[model samples]
Target: MPASALEGIDESTWVDVIQKMDEVYSQLIDDEIELEKKNAELEQSQQFIFSVLSAMSDVLLVCNERGVIEETNAALCELVGRTDAELHGTSLYELLADPLSVERARTVLGNTNPARRGEGLELNLFDAQRQSVPVDANCTPRVAASGRRVGTVFVARPTAEIKRAYHELRSAHEALKRAQQQLLHSEKMASLGRLVAGVAHELNNPISFVLGNVHALSRYSNRLRAYLAAVHAGEPAEQLQALRGKLRIDHILDDLPSLIEGTLEGAQRTADIVNSLKRFSAMDPEDRIPVDLNEVIKRAIHWIGKGAVPDFEMRWQPGPPLMVMGSAGQLQQVLMNLLQNAQDATAAHGKADKLVSIETEVVENCVRLHLRDNGPGIAPEHLSHVFDPFFTTKPVGKGTGLGLSISYGIVEHHGGVLSVCNQIDAGAEFLLELPLAH
Candidate 1:
């Protein structure tokens, strides 16, 4: 029967049948190859996604509309002490540490809107040891390709970790602030060191006057004691008068008052100088007080002038008291820095008549102090960087370069502005402006 069936089919028909079968087989082979390639790509994608989820530090969960856990990352699995198989198909609410968290989770997961996103919800969950761990959780609605809401995706970070990070950041900030303050104090002390010579000279005048007055008073005391002893010895009045004339008692009595007054003045002056030095050398207090800029300028000039060369002169006509709110020591430091810089500039230029002139005026609600020097003007390229830290025109050991920089910062802290420029004629002028105290 099979031979009879084959005999009815012609050879060409059989050839066509064999060729169609070969074509069909070839097509099937190609399809199989394409399917293998697609399978390989899918496997690679799954591995990549798994690796990403495993590497993430935050806890991740994917749940269906019923709050049934469908997928979870390694972090979540490890946190709850469960395997992927155990976590799958479990109710997400079962892992919540409290009823409040369960209610919150239900509310977040129940929202079916595709555009809804829940963020920064503090939820507590049970860890492997059944201990509560607070987390900052974010929930976003998961949507299907057909635009239908299917489930929710949750990502959470531990609050303890975030708090630790914030604490560390605050500590670093405080440390940096302390370091900056120390640097400022170091620069201030360095400036004070440069004024030692001037301070010594300033102290010498008052101290020497006081000593001279004290010596004279001692001699007068001895003469008075001798005269009194003679009078008390019951000597005759003529003899006592002769003794008084010999000892110059009348002159001593007249000069005693003047000597005492001068001594007191000298002592007071010394005390004032010492107090100024103490204020300048001490750390600036945070409290601000009304300071007279004119007085500060005068003191700065007096101190800096004592150390200047014999030919150097500072001309200042203080008009009135310009009251500003700031640390007096800081303002004095700024003025001293300006004056010193002026003196240095003039001396460097080899000016025979070295002079620094200062003027103060009220402009609007601010006080402006202008200090000008007679010297070679600042270089065009150097003017812009004069207030930069570690920028100086003097020789290596002659300057620290922090003077103007620190002074600039001090003025700024006192609500002031300090700037420098080359005078049109020939010199450098510094302009300082500070707000007036109410």
Candidate 2:
């Protein structure tokens, strides 16, 4: 029946079967072409990514769950001075230069999902020369399309350059701090020199007067003792009286008390000058505390005045205690410097109405202080450099010129500003502004 069925098959049925087979074959060829295109595209994409990884300067590594290096970038190969074939199948932990780092990496890799481990890890890696290089490393998990953990990827950067940079930065900071300290010391010495000069000049008269009076008193006492000895020797009362008269005992007794009083007053004046000098020259460089600007200003005024009221008419417009954080000693020195400068300017100009005005106000959360002198204003050309160290307008010996510069530094340390400008119609006006403590 099979033979008879085959013979009975029509030519048209055979042609139709052949046509159907051709159609199926054509469809298979088209599918194969599409598959090849997709494969080529995928290969191209992988090559692009591989090229990118190879081009990167940082070391990149792909490791399997066993912690065996499966793939590495050109950077890693070059760093180890090995070809990829030699690097592959190597233990990642063996590449670490530090024993502790190797142990840490091994422990981390023991986890089922080793990815997301070793973030911010600083490790020492061995180079081809067996020299250790610092590096920072990060790891992340590689997952397959089916959501299975396939491997771990590590990205690392050489930290030697960064460490060098950081070390350089710290050195620069230390140098800057040293320079600042030296500047502070220089300024303090300059202030101390000025204080010495002022004390010498002001105390000279009183001290000299006291010494002269003491010598005169000593001679008077000797004369008086001689007269007393004559009386004690039982000489004639008239003779003793004559001796006293000849010695001028009456006038000596009368003037002794006044002379002693003048000497005492002069001594007291010297003491006050010394005390003021001590207070004004206090240079506690590192003390910071809450202090009242008004009180400091008043003390400074008293010091600069040197016992007697200052020659210039001075007025203080004080506000409520303006509390600021600063060194009291330093602030006092600052005020003394400013006041002295004003005095010199006023005295030089010989103003008939020599007036120095000081005022304080609170504005915009800041404590503002203003000091103005009725003297000639600063020249425009010299105004900008007024606060510059060693800058001066007076005679060389008359001024060390560190007054304003040091004052400016003190104010800055207190988070304040000191500025000077010429007043509209009179002299130079200085403004000291400080931020109020919260």
**Which candidate gets the maximum lDDT versus the true structure?**
1
Quote the lDDT for 415 in model 1: 75
Residue 71 shift from truth in candidate 1, angstroms = 1.1
Per-residue error for 339 in candidate 2, Å, reads 9.0
Q: Provide the overall lDDT of each model, using Cα atoms, as 2-decimal numbers.
A: 0.86, 0.84
lDDT (tens digit, per residue) of candidate 2 on 1-438: 588779979999999999999999999999999999999999999999989989999999899878899999999988877888998999887788989888767665666745454455677788899888888888777778998887778888999888899999999999999999999999999977865675576678778889999998998999999998998899998898899999899999999989999899888877865554444343454677789988899899989989446789888966788898778778888889899999989989987889899999999889989999989989999999898655788873466466787788778878899999999996999999998866
lDDT of 2 at 191: 77
> Candidate 1, 81: how far from true, in Å?
1.3
Worst 10 residues of 1 by lDDT: 276-285
lDDT (Cα, tens digit) per residue for candidate 1, span 313-352:
8798887789999888788988998888888888888978
Model 1 scores a C-alpha lDDT of: 0.86
1 Cα displacement, candidate 1 (Å): 5.5
Regions of candidate 1 where Cα sits further than 4 Å from its true position: 171-205, 227-438
